[model samples]
Target: MKKFIIAIDGYASTGKSSLAKQLSLHLNYVYVNSGSMYRAITFFALKNGLTPLNKENIDRLINLLPEIRLDYRTNNVTGISEIHLNNKNIEGEIKTLEVSEYVSLVAEISEIRKFVVKIQKSFKNKNGLVMDGRDIGSVVFPNADLKLFLKASEQVRAKRRYDELINEGYTVEYKDILENIINRDSKDTKRKDSPLIIAKDAVVIDNSELSINDQLDIIIRLINSEL
Candidate 1:
């Protein structure tokens, strides 16, 4: 059986990662979350107080991306490969709102995108993989066999994000979360390097009103046909 590369691209907190992971496991394919590459960079920036304006610093960061290995270690109980950055398990830290603020800023850097793209390509060489990020379908893996662009209304995505932050013990406002989502969408779409856009051949999954199981079924059917 020939394997197909599944590329899922979407905005933050849109459940793209969850769906991608499930599909990968079901199909026995490798699952890669490309956004974590940028998040790991932001984690480094915050630790070193490196601002986005520092072009040289960003370039230095790019040079170091190869050292930031994103290993996924499944939990002893929950059975999920928690994201790890540079031998350290920073999944809890990377989910914070501050990381959210800087991710787009860092992602907009061309050098950073170039560096991350290099890693993404290595994982897709055999094509039995599912990768999700803002640019996977349109830029990083445009030749992927299947492309999914997931989206929802701003209000819906914002509320989901707000609840996620609260559950994570962050003191945040719903209004602020909504605004942040809007700002991120604008920034992501306006980004110079591989801006977020629906590819011409991409299948649009408007998950605005669907449950996870329903969404999974729809996508599974689409992929099964191709496989």
Candidate 2:
């Protein structure tokens, strides 16, 4: 069997992570959530009072980047992977509305993007892997065997995000999530460093009306053809 590097890129809350996880599991490949890496950094900055609103503070956060260690550990019971920051499991903390509010700001920094890209690239050398993020296909792994760019309407994406957050016990407003999604879309696409652009050879998937099984079936059929 030929292993593949699967890169899934899209705007925030487009179900990129969910799709990548399922694809990886179905193929017994490694699933990597690239956005969680940035969120973890954003979470660390906020906890340490290094808000991206202050240019100097953002620089300080970059300076302290050497001390930041990001990794993943799979849970034995559920066989699901969790993001780890400096050996602490923070999968739960990084998904909050607070992290979403500032993650784009943190990710807009060139140094931060570069740092995360380096880690993202390292996963490719290990085994068959599926990575999902804003820039995974366009920047992190341009030569990936399979590249998928997922997209959805802002309203739909926001609603999906709102429901997920609420289910996770976060008190969030739909309007706020919509605004954040819009802001992130602008920042992610307009940022100078590794802006979220679809690769020339990537397949675009508008999954706004598609169910999880429908989406996965589409991707699996594509993968089978490739194999």
Candidate 3:
């Protein structure tokens, strides 16, 4: 069996990560949540007091990039891969609303994108891989075998994110999540480097009204066709 790469790109809270993870498990591919890489860097910056990453401190952050070590380790119990920063499991830490607030800003930096993209591109060496991010298809892996661009209405995406945070024991307002989604969309699409856009040959999935299983079935069919 020949293995191929799947690149999933989309706006924040559009379920790109969820779908990509599912596909990875189903296909027995290495799953990479590219957004988590950005979040880890953002969390690091926040911990080190290097943000509101201005012109003055941006260079400092860039210099510190070599010190950042990111990798994924699968949990034996849940069988899910969790991201680690500096060999420490920071998956739980990076998922906070605080990290969410700054991730897009950190990702907008060209140097940050280049650093992460270098790591992202290396994953393709493994052959069978599923990676999801704002620019995975458009920038990181333009020749990916299958590229999916996900989209949903702002209200729907916000509600999904709010439910996720609430279930995680975080007290968050839906309005705030909605605003963040809107703001992230703007920043992601307007960024001077690697702005989020659908690859010309990519398939777009508007999952506003679809269930996870529905999405899985649809994507599985697409994968079969590709195979």
Candidate 4:
């Protein structure tokens, strides 16, 4: 069987990562959460006091990018790849609301995007791959075999994020999550470089009212049609 790439692009909290993870497992493909790469960088900047990104800090972050090492290691228990920074597993650290707040700002940097994109492209060497992020379909893998742009209403997305954080033991307000989602949507779409736009031939999946199984079925049918 010929292996192919699936690129999933969407706004924050739109379940891009979740759907990509599921698809990867179902197809026995490599799964890459591109947003986690940005979050790792943001976490690094925050840890090193380089955030609130002004011109000076941005330049510093760019210079410091050389020292930042990122890689994915699959967990034996879950069989899912988790990102590591500088040989340390910072997966749990990068999922906090604080990281979410700064990740979009970090992703907006041109140098950072270029650095991450170079790494993202290398994943194509895998036998098969499923990658998800704001610009995966539009920028990273424009020729992907199947490109999905996921969307959901702000309220639904915020609620989903809120529930996730709460279940993770973080006390968060739904209003704050909603605001972050809105802000991220604006920043992601208006970013000067690699703004989130649906590829001309990509399929748009409005999963606001759909379940995960429903999405999986739809994508499976599409893949079968392509085959």
Candidate 5:
């Protein structure tokens, strides 16, 4: 059976990662969360004080790109791939709201996008994979066999994200999460490099009212037709 590269692109908290992971697992393909890569970079910047407060700091972070290393390792207990940065498991740190707040800023840097997009494209040479991020379909894998653009209203996405964070024991306000979602949407769409845009040929799924199983079924049927 020939395998297809699946690219899922979308705004934050639309469940792109969850959907991509499920698709990859079902198809026995490698799953990569491209956003996690950016988050890892943001996490590093925050820890090292290379924040985007000024151009000088952003330039400093850009210069240190060569020193950063990112990879995924399957967790024995969870049986899911977790990101490793600098040979340490920073996956736990990368998903925090702190990283979320900074990831879009880091992702906006053309240098950072170029750095990560190179790594993202390398996965194509290996085998079939499912990758999801803001620019996966538009920039990283423009020729991907199946492209999906997931979206939901800002209120829905923000509620989902807030619930996720709260479930993870993070103290957060719904209003703050909503503001972050709105801010991220603005930044992501306005970024000069690889701004988040639906590919012309990509299928769009507005999953605000769809259950996970329903969404999965719809996508699986589409994949089956493609296969």
Candidate 6:
């Protein structure tokens, strides 16, 4: 069987990561949750006190990008990658509301994208890999054998995100999350570098009305057809 790159692109809380994980497992491929990389960078910037406009500080931080390592680990009998920076696992910390708020800001930096893209490219090498993120299909792996763009209504996505955060004990308002989703959608589409766009040959999936299994079945069918 020839290895191929699988790119999943979508907005926040659209279940891109979840579906990617399932597909990777089914195919025995490596799964890279690209958003976690952005969140890790956001956590680093916050801890180092580098605000959005602090170019020098941000550049200095990017230089340390090589120290970031991500790997899947079994925890509590479930498998998920532990994101490490300089040898310390910051998975739990990086998923906080603070990191969530500033992640898009850090992600807008072209320097950071370049730094991470280099790492992502190396991982795909001749691809038996599943990678998911905002611009994965269009930017990170444009030539991927299979590409999917996932989307859902703003209210639906916000509700899902709010519920997830609430379950994790994060204090958040549903309306506020909805507003943030709109704001992120704007920024993600308008960003100067590698803005999110559905690639010409990709399939668009509106998952708002679909169950997880439905979505996964659709994607698996698409992948099979593509292959």
Residue-level lDDT of model 5, residues 95-164, one tens digit each, is: 7788888888898898999999988888887577889999888888888988999999999999999999
Model 1 earns a TM-score of 0.90
Better of 1 and 5 by lDDT: 5
The prediction achieving the highest TM-score against the true structure is 4
Would you estimate the TM-scores of all the predictions? Answer: 0.90, 0.98, 0.97, 0.98, 0.97, 0.90
Candidate 3 segments whose C-alpha is farther than 4 A from its true place: none
Q: Per-residue lDDT tens digits of candidate 1, residues 44-155? A: 8888767654778786776776666766666567555667877888878887888888888898888778878887788767548888999898888888888999999999
**lDDT of each prediction vs. the true structure?**
0.83, 0.91, 0.90, 0.93, 0.88, 0.81
Candidate 1 residue-wise lDDT at 154: 94
Residue 223 alpha-carbon offset, candidate 4, angstroms: 0.5
- Writing each residue's lDDT as its tens digit, candidate 3 over 160-205 gives 9999999989999999999998999999899899998889999999
User: Candidate 4 — which pairs collide?
Assistant: none
Q: Model 6 residue 119 lDDT?
A: 70
| lDDT score of residue 70 within candidate 2 | 99
Q: Model 6, 210: alpha-carbon shift in Å?
A: 1.1
Q: Residue-pair clashes per candidate, as listed?
A: 0, 0, 0, 0, 0, 0
lDDT of 6 by residue, 14-64 (tens): 989888887877777878888888888888778877765477877777776
lDDT of 6: 0.81
- Please identify model 4 stretches exceeding 4 Å from their true place: none
Q: In model 3, what are the clashing residue pairs, if there are any?
A: none
Question: What pairs collide in candidate 1?
Answer: none
